[model samples]
Target chain A: MSGGLTLVVALPLLAALILILLSRLERRKGAIAGPGFFQRNGVAVGLYLAVAVGFWAFFIIVLPQLAMVDLSFRPKLPPSQMGGPKDIFTLENYRYFLFGSTTSTANWNWLHIKAFFLSIGVSILITLLNLAICYPLAFHMAQSAPVARLRVLLLLLIIPYWVNEILRAFAFRVLLSSGGVVNKLLMGGGLLDAPIDFLGNDVGLYMGLSYAYLLMMIFPLYNAIESLDRNQIEAARDLGAPWWHIHAFVVMPHAKPGIASGCTLVFMLSAGALAAPLVLGGPRTLWFTPIVYDRFYQAFNWPQGAAYALILLFACIVFVLAVLRMFRLSLGEIAR
Target chain B: MAAAVELEGVNVTFGDFVAVRDANLTIEPGEFFSFLGPSGCGKTTLLRTISAFIEPTRGTVRIGGRDMKGIGPNKRPTALIFQNLALFPMMTVAENIGYGLRVRGVPRHERDEKVKNLLIQIALPEHGHKLVSELSGGQRQRVAIARALAVEPSVLLLDEPLSALDLKLRQHMRAELRAIQKRVGITFIYITHDQGEALTMSDRIAVMNAGVIEQVGNGRSVYAEPRTPFVASFVGENNAIRGRITQAANGTATLDTPIGPLTGRNPVGLPAGDEALIFVRPEALKLGGDPPSGFEGEALDVTYEGSITHVTMRVRTGQKITLSLGGGAAGILPQPGDMLKVGFEPQDGLLLARPERS
Candidate 1:
C-alpha cells in the first residue's frame, strides 16, 4: 500500500492509544470535587470510542462498496484461474473512472451536481404539495368530525404505506403505461389522440416519485395542524377579524414549528431516495443515484462508487447541518 | 326601547343530542349577566349561540333590537374571551390588545395610542411589550379583558376566563372583572360553571341545568329564594329535608317528614298533597342551648373550618341537619354525636314543588 493509505489507517489507531493511556493516567489521579476521576476518565474514553465506532460505522455500513471489495476480491487486477496474488496499490480503476481509460471506457465519474439540484427541486415541490393538500383537510376535519372518524381517515392514509415500496411503484407503472386504464380513459374522452408516453419517461418518473414520498411530508403537516389550539381561531372570529386575518395571525404562527420540522424531514428523505428513482425513472430521467449503481454493478468500479457514495452522504449531511443552523435546532431536537 | 341582549326561545342542538333547549332570557343594557351551571349543562352553548359561533336551531338572537340573522361573528359588534383566555402567546401584550384595531385598518399611531391606554386601564402598564407567556396569571387575565375591551363592543362575552388561574388570583380577577365591566359600561354576558364567580360578579344570574334555565334573578334573590331544586342544590350548601306536604297556606307550609311535622316557608307552584324538599342553608340553621324559642334538635357532628364551625345533628325523629355556627360565639364548640337543640325559622327553608330525585 502507498504511504498515504498506510497513514490513513494508522492515525485513528494512534489517537485511540493516546485516549486509553490518558484514561489510565486520570484514574490514578483519584477523585475530585466534581465527578469521580475514574468516571470522568471513562467519559473521555467513551467519547474516543464513539469516534472510533462512528468511523467504522461509516467505513462498513455507509461506504459498503469499497469495504466489500477490499475484504473479498483481488484489489489490483484479474485473478488467475483458482485465485492468485494481486498487487495492492494499483491506481488502474480510479484512472478508469476519472479519465475513462480505453480498458473501461463506459465508466462515468460521479459529478453529483445534477442529482443534488434535482433532489432540491423535488423536496420543495413535495413540501408545497403537502401543505396545500393537508392544510384545508386537516383544519376542517379537526373541529367538525368525531375523534373516531379522524382516526379512521388517518389510518387509511397510513395503511397504503404498509405495502412494499416496489409494489407501489409497480402499481404506478401500471397506471402510467400506454394501455393502462388512466391513458385509455383520457384517450376515449378525446383528451388525447393517442395514449401518451408515461412510463419509461420523465412524466412517469415524477408521478411515481411523488407518490412514494408524499406520505412523509403529509404526516408531519397533519400532526402540526391537529395540535393547533382551536379556541384561538374562535377568539379571532370573536375579535371581528376576518377569516384570512385569523389564519395569518393566530393559526399559522402557532403551527410554524410543526411546519419547520415536517419540511426538514421530508426534504432529507426525498433527497436520499433510491428505490423510486432506480425503478420508475427512465433512461432520460438520470438522477445521482443510478450513477452510483452503474459504477458499482456494471463498471466493476468499487473505489469510485465509494467516493461517489461518500459525496452524496456528505451533501445530505451538509444540507441537514445548514437547516439546523438556520433554525437553531440539532438532530436531538428534531427526533420524532 | 328593548333590552340590550335578548334570546327568544333559543335552542342549540348537537347532532342527535340537544345541548340547549328552548331558553328565554333578556339582559338590559349595561347589565352583568351570567349563565351558571355544572359542566355540559349548556351554559357554554348558550354563550356561543349569542356569539354567533353556534347558531340557534330554533330562536332568534336580538342585540339592541336588531335581529342577528345572516350575521357572523366578524360582523357582530361583540367579543368573547374564551375559557382558556385564548391570548395569543406568539404576540406581545400590546400587539394582542391592538389586534382588533389592527384588523380594522386603523392607522399604526392610533392603534398604538389605544393599546397604551388599554394597558394602563388593565393596570399592566409596564407589561405592554412582554410576551403573553412572560406575564403572570393575573396579568394574563387582565390582558384578556383589555383585549376584549379594545374592540369597543356593545356587549362583551366572557367564557370562564378566570378558570385557568390559581384560587387567589381567581378571586382577585373576579373583583377586577366586575370593576372593568362597570368601568366600560358595556353589557357583559359571562359563562361559568362556578356559582361563586357568578354570584359575586353578575348583576343578574341565570341558573341553567340540562339545557333549561332553572331561574334568573338578582344574586341575593337567587341565593335567598331559589325557585327550583336544581338551583337550590347548585347555588350553595343547603340541607334538603325531604318530606310530604300536609297543608299549604299564606306562603307557609306544613310537611310530615322523617323529623316529624315540620313547618317551613312555602315556594310558589307547590300545592297541598305534593311531595317537596325544603332547602335550608347551613348558616341559617342555629345550634345552641334550647334552640332560641320554638325548635329542637341534637348535634351529631361538628366540623370547624377556621371562622365558622359546621355542626351536623339530628332533629326529633332521626333527620340529620347541618348548621353553621360562628367561631367567636360565646359558647362551647359542639362535637360529633352530641345531642343538642336546633332551630331554623319557617322563613329559612324555601320549599321546592318538585324536589330533585337524587
Candidate 2:
C-alpha cells in the first residue's frame, strides 16, 4: 500500500520535471547539440541539483505527511484483523475528536478542545510579547550600538541558545521553583513579601517559551532594520517627528516582512512545543500536544493521534495564511 | 520667515580625532551659504552641529538670536536633506512630504492640502500619490526637498545631495535648488565636495580642510583671492611650485624656484627667506605670451572639452603644468613630446606660506 502511494505521488512529479526540461530544451533547440552546450556547464549542474532536491523533499517530507494523512482516515484494529471487515475506512477516529467516544455520547470533548484553543491563544500572546521585547533590542543592535559592542551583544544573545532547548526549559523550571534563586533574590531585595508560586501558576511555562523563541524573533527583525538607511531616521527627526512617530511611520513599516516572518515562526513553534510544556507546565496548565502524545503512545491509537495532529497542522496553516494576508506579504518575501 | 544661524567656537571630536575644530561662522538670514570641502574635511560635522544632530564638544549654536544649547534635532528650526535623500519608501510622495504636519497633529485634510501645495511647488504635482521608490532620481530629490520644506524650517541643510545623480540632472537640480531657496526665502546651508556647485549656487562659500575653516568669502573672491595654501590648492586646479621667498614687499613677493625666480601676489606677506608656495590656476597660464614668469615644457597630452581645451606639459623642473585655452583661441594644438612655452602674470599667481608637514 505504501509502495502504491509513493508511485501515485511520484508519477505526477516526474512528469512535471520532464515537461519543464522539454520546454527548456525547446528554447535552446540547436544549442543542445552544439559545442557551446558542453562548454556551458551551468545547465547540467542545475538539472542535477533540482533532481537531488526533489528526490529528498519527496521521500523525506511529502511521503511521511501523506502517510499520516492517509492513516488519519483508517480504523484502528489488531494486525490479525487488518484485512477484515472491521478494518475498513471510517470517520470514527475524527468523530472521537469532536465527541468523547466512538459510540454516540452526544457530548463534546470540551477538555481537549479547550486545551487546543488555550494552546493557540497562549502562543499568540507569547508571539506579541516576544515582538515587544525584541523590537527595541534589535533596533539598538542594528543601528545605534557601536560595532564592537554589537558583536559582544550578538555573542551574548547566541551563547545562551547553544544549550539544548529541553535542557534550557528544565533550567527554567529550577529557576522558577518556589525555593529558586529568582524568588530568593526578590525576597532578599525586599521587592516581594514571599516566594511567588511561579511553577504552580504557569508563569514558568510562559517564561520558558518566550526565552526559547527570542532569538528567532530578534535575528529577522535585526536583519530587516539593519538594511534601513540611518538617514531615513534622521530625516524623520529633522522633519520634527518624535521617536515614536519615526518608528510608526518609517521603521515599523519597513520591517513588516521581518515582523510577519518572526511572529509566524514563534507562534508555530510555541503551539507545537512539547518540551517546554512538559518541563514547566503547572498542574492546572493543560496543553493539547500532550493529549496527542497520549493518544499515540499511552493508548496505542495511531489513527486518533494522526487525526489530532492533522487538526493542529490545519490550524497552523490557517494562522500562517491569516498572518500573510494581514501583513500583505507574499510567501517568497518571508522566505528571504 | 528665515533666521540667522551662528556657530561660535564650535568643535567636534570623536575620541582623539578632531572632526571640526573651533568653527566660527554667522550665516545670514535668507542667504544661500555652503560648506565646501573634500571628504573627511569636517564639513558634514559642522553642518550636523548647526542642525543639532551632533552637539559641539565645546561652543554654542544660536538660531534666530536664541541659544540652542539643549535643543534636539526635532525641536530645531532646521531640516536636513541627506546625501541619499532618505525618502520613506513605504509612504507615498504626499505622505512623505506631509509627515511633519501629521506628527504635529494637523488634521488629515489640512495635511493633504499642504502636501498638495508642496508637490506643486516642487513641480511634482502628479507624483504625490506615487510611492517614493516609483519616482525617478530627480523626482525623489524633489520629494525630499518638499518633505523638508513642509515644516517651513528657517534653515535647510543639504549634505552632498546631488552627488548621486548624473551630471545633467545634478546641474539641473543645482539651478532648481537655487531657485527654490530663493523663492522660499530661507537660509540654505549646502555641503559638497564639488567646488562648482558652491561657486555657482552659493552667496558665500566656506572652504574647509583638516578640521579647520581655511577661508570664507563670496565665490569670486574665494576663487581669485584665497587666503591659505590649502584654500588655493582645494578650490581649483592649480600648478603648485615650492620655493623660498626671495623678496617680499607691498603684498607681492618673489619666489626663487628650480626654474627661475617667480613673483606673485603674497597675500599673507611672508618675509624674505621664508619658504613659500605659489599657485597659478590652469586658466591663468598663457600658452605663448610675454609674462613676468615663464617656463618651457614638452607637451604630454592635450584634451579638448567643448568650450575649453586643456594642454598638459612637463616643465624643465619635471613638474606637470596645465594650461587652458579658450575655444575661440586660434592655435595649433600641441601633441606629445612637443616643446611649448607657458607663462602667467604676477597678479594671476598666488603666493602663500607652505603648509607644515602633518
Please name the candidate that would achieve the greatest TM-score relative to the true structure. 2
- The count of backbone overlaps in candidate 1 is 6
Chain B TM-score for the candidates in order? 0.94, 0.97
Name the best candidate (by lDDT).
2
Model 1, stretches more than 4 Å misplaced? A1-116, A137-144, A199-201, A321-331, B267-269, B287-295, B304-307, B326-328, B332-335, B356-358
Worst 10 residues of 2 chain A by lDDT: A30-39
The per-candidate count of clashes, in order, stands at: 6, 0
Clash pairs for candidate 1: B297-B340, B297-B342, B298-B340, B299-B340, B300-B313, B300-B337
In candidate 2 chain B, where is summed lDDT lowest over 10 consecutive residues? B326-335
Per-model C-alpha RMSD: 6.3, 3.4
Encode model 2's per-residue lDDT on B196-311: one tens digit a residue.
99999999999999899989999998899999888888888888999999889999999999878888998777999999899999998887778889878899998888789898
Screening candidate 2 with a backbone cut-off below 3 angstroms (N, C-alpha, C), the clashing residue pairs are none
